[model samples]
Target: MKNSAMIEACLACFAACEMCATECIKMISADHLRCIALCRDCAEICALCIKLEQRDSEFSHDVMQLCVESCTACAAECEKFAAHHDHCRECAEVCRKCASECQAA
Candidate 1:
């Protein structure tokens, strides 16, 4: 349970990212394409990080690093649409938290 906090953060971020991506798709446009792609990638990376950490994989640290990067990028992209999208705002916040947790882990 050493990585409990990190896992929790990743779970939250994963949910947020998925929700954001779904919303983005509903409002699909050229401007939202990057946001959607980033959210999807971030969610996938968060899920992978959770699995790696749970099993205490040898590559957990490496994956966490990648997760941090992914979350950071996703958060930034989502933030751009925060003014017009609640889901993007929420996802950005969760992504930031997850990135912080991943860095700590």
Candidate 2:
């Protein structure tokens, strides 16, 4: 597993995104909508990245790149409300780490 570290990072990010989305849904509002959407998207993409990386798919590189983009966008969106939301802060942190890992991978 050459991408073992990246896979771990994606797993953590996926979990964080899920948690963040769940929290955002509970506190749904106009401002939280984008965060919620991004979290969901990020989580889905991370899952796909994990599967692709695990099997060493031919499309793993492309999917990892997409994951990087998604994680970056999701992290930025989550950071907006990080001041008041613990979940957002935590998610942002994980997303950032995942983005870096994916990019390096």
TM-scores of the models, in the order given: 0.97, 0.97
> Per-residue lDDT of 38-70 in model 2, one digit per residue for the tens?
999999999999998888799999999999999
CA RMSD of each candidate after superposition: 0.7, 0.8
- Which tens-of-lDDT digit does each residue in 1-105 have in candidate 1? 758899999999999999999999999598999999999999999999999888989999999999999999999999999999999999999999999999998
Residue 55 Cα positional deviation in candidate 2, in Å, after optimal superposition: 0.6
CA deviation > 4 Å runs, candidate 1: none
Output candidate 1 Cα RMSD: 0.7
